[model samples]
Target chain A: MNDAPVTAPPRAAALALGDDALVLSHRLGEWAGHAPVLEEEVALANIALDLLGQARILLSLVGDEDELAYLREERAFRNLQLVEQPNGDFAQTIARQLYFSTYQLFLYRQLAAGDSAFTGLAAKAVKEVAYHQDHAAHWTLRLGDGTAESHERMARACGALWRYTGEMFEPVEGLEVDWRALEDSWRESVAGVLERATLTLPDGPRSGAWRAGAGRQGLHTEPFGPMLAEMQHLHRSHPGASW
Target chain B: MSSSTDWPLWEVFVRSRRGLSHTHAGSLHAPDAEMALRNARDLYTRRNEGVSIWVVPSSAITASSPDEKDPFFASAADKPYRHPTFYEIPEGVKHL
Candidate 1:
């Protein structure tokens, strides 16, 4: 093994974002065979795969994909709680997607403008995030207006998720400017969409402020451990093996 | 506006970039025109495949039935002059 000490922290930061994508994608994939509407089931699955693909590219960029994806312990994972929180119901899933994808749209747009070393990757990602945002926005409008029951559930989902959304913009220590501006822009955009969808943005302890940190510092929620165990079981059980 | 009618079916067309013709993409369901356009963008243009999109309710499309294919198209086949082969170019024709 090469013993060179890695200096710059941005590489690791990239992995933090990548880890969020991987974990959230795993949750999103759970809806593949199980969305309320058949069409939506397909749509969610496709979007999940898109996120997973992004995760793969991102994780691989930071370190070995296998190590980043499968070898890490739970606490070692850096995914935000927003991505790790359990997906509740259809409303909850839509809420999560709306929250995450909207943020992703802003992040990608800024990254495309920024001179990230991964310019090509950021360029490709912008397209996917734009569509993901559209998907989430459509769901937000539908569930918010569909029926009294749906509206109530969606509202609850937004309130529950709104708090967790804070961590998405929590800047990496010493890398604050990199993420802070994007976070502010994302909020403005999300607010507009929420207004149009008739959804209320929550104001509470969990609203766009850090309930926890060190997802950037490589600390993760409780869910990360079990998630990694499952994701890595097959690969770790038989290392150096061909598919 | 029958409540019994199913959600509107939208016909999708995507123009991948400027100066390109909008080509048929596929179809989806949405509650309104705006949502229809958004759905088409999400489903068909997720990969930056299109810079522009169009969505028309499938009900609005009036397609000729397959049962009338022969009767509808038979006249065209007999119009040999429509092919432009009947027109002879002069010896000096530059682009004939």
Candidate 2:
């Protein structure tokens, strides 16, 4: 590791954000051959590629991208629990996408408006995340209102994913975005999408002991370890080999 | 959960750039118009191939049958005088 004179705070922020993108990109990529339809396969892959691009940029700011992605232990990752969760059914995946993409769009928008280390990347990434948010919102609306079975699955997924969302708005030391405003905007937009979809806002607790995440402190949930092993397998198997 | 077979087929059209007409791309299945547009974006524009997309239900389109090709197009084919290519333009003329 190159121990530079840069302060600890920005490095930590970059790792947190970068890991979120990397983990979620991997999760999305897992759907490459398995999405419910051909169109969905293309859609999910594009979204995965976009997130991977963002992750590479963000991780490069902190350290070697390959090492950060493939060599780190599970405990070393700082991704949100929401991103690391397995792709359950399609509805669950959409619920996760809706929640995280909404938060990411607001966060990037806030960062882009200010002069920070993140400003340039945030400005560029905000547009892509806007599309991602729109995609998730569209699917949520479709699945929520299409049929009784779809509505039940969608509603259940929304409730299951709700517990992991509070961690997104928690303050990071170096990032300058206002956490409270971000949380409020995220809630308002998500609620609006859910209402328009004919789905109710999840009644699950967001910030109390019942909450489901501690990822900001490098703590993750149960699913991350196996996922990390799979993601790192090729890179780890062939040390320094490049195709 | 609707089966994949239940989704309706939509024909995709793409405008590759500004000032261009949307051309037929391909087809994909979607539950509704909104999803159809999004599916077209992902399927047709993944390589920066399009600037805009239009999705129409395949059932909504009316097309000429290939079996009627000679009967349907023979009338127009014989009207060779309608072709601007046959017009003689003076060498001094610029665009004509």
Candidate 3:
């Protein structure tokens, strides 16, 4: 019997992660035609494009792109809870972006430097993320120090999103991707930047809890159902539709 | 400096990744030179197009008035003989 090496255990897991990115990118694109300001709209669109591009690479590396995106059920998504949250308002959207991009920036930086099969992907992805971080950091400074209402809104948005922060760093089973060495370093780096911007790093939650343990196991938050239906409708309804 | 009541608009120029010359990117609102530069970095360099950026307050710019259009430099257009063209091809001009 001849043998080719079996696929890595993490393949499905990583594809799930990639799907999270792709879905979130699509959601962010909804803001493109309707952001509060023209400049802000362009910024969000750019960030969305970057993430979508990253998702494509990550998905292709793992398996078939369409299947990775469409075949998966709502429960299979592994995005942090923050990303799946709806864009409630301008402040809320920016706050979600800032939180996710901050975390993604850290995650990508570590992966770029680490020993991983996805080193090439991570390296290029990290280059794009530098801009994402800058975008978020800039807005954080402006909104935090802006007019009184803006300041209050930012604080509230951060407070709401902070609870989702833990999901970013929380480990998932069989994903087995490790940034253990860079964990503290990443945290400190983001903390310093936030401090310089004069924004507080929002705490996780008052419930003293995180929605964990199920992301990788095909379990998801309540919002995932509608997001999936919208995302996968065409592909599911008309199988084999293509360019 | 104290008399300045509003934020001075800054024009950003970015030199993407060791590029020789900086190109005008866009503008951002900021109070001073240092803040403008930082904002420029945040807005322009975030995409990593730039290894460096320059921000100059829009007010500090001294530009020739478009209203004085014909009088200012219109004289140069008629002076073609003021060029080196008149003497350049005389005899053997080595490597000219």
Which candidate achieves the best TM-score against the true structure?
A: 2
lDDT of 2 at A20: 91
- Order the candidate numbers by DockQ, best to worst: 2, 1, 3
The single-chain TM-score for chain B of candidate 2 is 0.86
Residue-level lDDT of model 2, residues B43-86, one tens digit each, is 88978999889999999999999999988998797787899887
What's model 2's lDDT at B64? 100
Clashing pairs in 1: A163-A206
Q: Which segments of model 2 are wrong by more than 4 Å? A: A1-9, B90-95
Instruction: Output the number of the DockQ-best candidate.
Output: 2
| Each candidate: chain B TM-score | 0.78, 0.86, 0.64
> What is the interface root-mean-square deviation of candidate 3?
8.6
The CA-based lDDT of model 2 is what? 0.91
Alpha carbon deviation, residue A53, candidate 2 (Å): 0.3
Per-residue error (Å), model 2, residue A58: 0.3
* Candidate 1 iRMSD in angstroms: 5.7
Query: TM-score (chain A) of candidate 3?
Result: 0.85
DockQ of each candidate's interface versus the true one?
0.20, 0.66, 0.15
